[model samples]
Target: MGDDAPVVERVVESQLAAFNRQALDEFMECYAESVELRIDGVVAASGKEALREIYARQFSVAPVRADVVLRIRQAEWIADHELIEGAAGGPTMSVLALYRVRDGLIDQVQFFGQRVTE
Candidate 1:
């Protein structure tokens, strides 16, 4: 683990906590101004304003939450295997989210998710 590992973990953890709480402002605080959010290898949103718009819509529509089932950290990167419930009124999902932290803020995130059919 590098010295930045803890910083990466802390920033990611904070983002997770904010998301789970449905606190969009707090969640946004953990991200950089020029952040990128990707889903299934596609760029879903770029920059803080776009991120806010996306999440704001989601937050107003449904009660979504994510719980991390497993986490792996390496230097400035953290990967989380998460169980997401109540996501846009859809089935539960298992998602693998990879996050990259830079200068104490999460600058990029990639999420790959599948419907949990159990």
Candidate 2:
């Protein structure tokens, strides 16, 4: 479990970097073929194909160039999984994510996100 922490942290960091760059293909590479992405405690997407569509649409609509302000408030390995708490100010969302990694790929993600309005 201790050894897995560093490896999992790297994977999570890679994914975040890809996402911030809007590199869908690179981001997808870190995920398993049958990946599951839960949003706000709901199964928003499953499988690489579905996830691809979601990201594609998002990237298409996003600004061509923008700064990424995503911040990791806390991160830890628990019960063979990585638990991450973060926030992205652009969307004003508080993020709670649990990642299940296997074979160096992110197999499942349980995400809890909520909009924050000030």
- Please tell me which predicted candidate would have the highest lDDT against the true structure: 1
Judged by lDDT against the true structure, how good is candidate 1?
Answer: 0.94
TM-score of 1: 0.96
Per-residue lDDT, model 2, residue 41, is 73
RMSD of 1: 0.9
* lDDT by residue (tens digit), candidate 2, 1-117: 566767677777777678768898998998889999887678888898998898788776753222223433233421222222222215455455667777778888776656555
Query: How many steric overlaps does candidate 1 have?
Result: 0
RMSD to native, candidate 2: 5.7
The lDDT of each candidate is 0.94, 0.65
- Model 1 spans with C-alpha error above 4 angstroms: none
Candidate 1, 26-77: lDDT as tens digits: 9999999999999999999999999999999988989899999999997888
- Model 2, residue 59: displacement in angstroms? 1.3
